[model samples]
Target: MLSDMRALTHRVRLDRRMTWTALLVLAVATLVAIPFDWFGMWVNCLPDGGCQFARNGMLWYWPAASFLAYAAIAVLYVRAARARGLGTRVLPYAITGAVTSLAFPAAWVALDAYFSDHPYPEGPLPYWWFVLDRLVMPWGMIGISLLVLAWLERNPALLAFAAGYLALVLLVLPMGDGFGSPHFGIRLGMALPQLIVGVVLLLGAFGFRRAARRPR
Candidate 1:
């Protein structure tokens, strides 16, 4: 009985560590990627420098950033589940998120192609698709990240990350409308929620780290 209890304790500790480490890595990767996203935003400011052009640097940068961020979140979910002996119960959600990650960039390309060529005499696919590609898809991934992690563990930091991210999606994102506005301030405002999420997540990650190190 004692041996079984010890093994269970060990698994719990492993789960805690793996989850915290994953959160830390995700936060750091996002912080690193922010500059690239910012550069993309800056490029959007140039005259006729919209991301619709294949030549636009944001086409390269933003997608790369998205890949890194989502990849980390996926790994976190898988590893955390394995640590807790959950056997990938949440893996499907992670996989779905990974697949949907491509939707945004694909949507961007389609929009650009249709607009540039004017192939359809119709009014250029539904504008709501732009909303989906810009706001729904990207923010949905953030929701997935929170779900995967929070399902396993709930900490102050995790809650903060979720709250801040949802605030952005619900409040800030609509105001900026995926940075579609011509106004530069509105575009930059798009970054505010992203930055808030990263900062809060990082704080939570370190908070977990400190708690783990505390002498039991």
Candidate 2:
């Protein structure tokens, strides 16, 4: 007996069948967001003529990218599903993403508050502690969102992407983002990791589409 898609599951992974074109657009959106670290409003202009290390860049970048990407994907996914006479739900993921985006900021605030309540007595705070906030940092909402989406979809590519991104982030954290340096090489070097990830995403879109087509 032939059963409709609705019989398989009440709610579908609408993005599971995302098109290459759609993926490319999503990739580009993510790629576009990589630069927010460079010119975000969440900057600390230091007296040294260089930007201070403030991890708030992710707050500007990820939310903006997510909004744009999710908005596009929502419309496109629903339109495609309806065209095929299949019902779908976007609200679940929307709610999930919204919640996920706050994970980093919330944790940061909690930690910041805790530290404020109990300041370091003798020595300075660990550098690593300060290096975590933006996507380039030790922790960021974009990373959190990526992890959440990866879990939701169980998408290996997204997982791999997150791992790769983290590797770059960890590598860059110690090197600093040209905070007090007046060298272009230092700043560009810091941004290079995200650029590579963006390129990987852009190129990986086609590969992901092809891989999805293989019989399981």
Candidate 3:
């Protein structure tokens, strides 16, 4: 029994295609859960902040669109990894990206529930929840940055472009108002550093890919 378990672990570790497929499935499942509010049980409000919107509208479609976009990218990553022979390292990075991507949305639901009753206008909720929410952004950024870094290690040029894209969004977008405003400069601050890291990672990945392609 122990030997069987070991063998299974070994197989999973070595099977890059299977690992990527699992990552893709995990990403899809996380995406599906977003609209349903399954990450944490709660009601969703419309942009007008009226009665909960029906499940079929933009509330569902927008997130679904986002999911589809990420899913497509994940598929492409899997294909590229396979062609390039990336193994278990890809699995860790993929998992990190998946978990990181889900963090903010998941925390938003919980924070909403906490804040709904207490109201930010009233005093803040217990300091812990506030701290947790603050932590989520950094934690999520790190996870995603790691994934980007991993990709950069595999394909520098592609990741450099992605980093540039992230930089552009950070610089140009009117994400929010002031420091107190949720949209303020926080995301830009977090993203800019990550993009720089991503550039370095891109160089590494490009080197790795080139080395992999060279004949012995």
Candidate 4:
């Protein structure tokens, strides 16, 4: 019996180690991708600097990163869920996160292509569709990120911080009188809030990890 118990303990430790290693790799990948312009390939600016390029850089980046990050979290959540004997509950979230991650980018690229060639406000597309295509999609991506954090059972403080940051982003999205108005101020506002949120999330993840490792 003692030998069996020892073996189980060893297995548990190994599992924990593997989980931590995978989480670390996912975290690093997310950190790297978050800042880069992953959707630049989809955009092409014309000489006139008109809607030729569809300069929705923030519109593209946030959703792309959110999807990727959430997919990672979903994986972690699945492992945790399985360990806790909640496989039925966790599998759906994991699958949804992965699907949404890929779908978000595809949708953004599709929108960019459609708008770039057709021109903005062509009269065929309704204004509400435009709002959905621009604002709703990005905010949905942020919502996915929050959902992933909730799945991971992250620290409450971290969750609150993310919530506040997302609220700020949503507020700012409509405030600039559409895109590129007061370009510098809009850029500053967007970048600064994201930076703050990213830092806070990182710190929170670290804190959660440390607390998890501590003996109860």
lDDT on C-alpha atoms for all candidate structures: 0.57, 0.57, 0.43, 0.49
**Residues 69-96 of candidate 3: C-alpha lDDT, one tens digit per residue:** 3455566657766775664344445445
lDDT of candidate 4 over 68-102, digit per residue (tens): 65566556656765786543233444555556555
- Candidate 4 segments exceeding 4 Å error: 1-30, 38-89, 113-119, 122-142, 148-162, 172-197, 210-216
lDDT (Cα) of model 2: 0.57
Report residue 148 deviation for candidate 3 (angstroms).
3.2
| Better TM-score candidate (2, 3) | 2
Error of 1 at 150 (Å): 2.7
List TM-scores for all candidates, in order.
0.56, 0.59, 0.37, 0.48
How does candidate 1 score on lDDT? 0.57
CA shift of 85, model 1, Å: 12
Residue 89's lDDT in candidate 2: 56
> Residues 65-122, candidate 2, lDDT per residue (tens digit)?
6666666766775787788777555555556556655565566678778878896557
Clashing pairs in 4: none
What TM-score does structure 2 among the candidates reach? Answer: 0.59
The 10-residue segment with the lowest total lDDT in model 4: 14-23
Give the candidates in order of TM-score, highest first.
Answer: 2, 1, 4, 3
The Cα error of candidate 4 at residue 76, in Å, is 3.9
Name model 3 segments beyond 4 Å from true: 1-75, 78-88, 121-163, 175-216
> Could you list the CA RMSD of all candidates, in the order they appear?
6.4, 5.6, 11.5, 8.1
Q: Which number leads on TM-score?
A: 2
Clash pairs, candidate 1, are: none
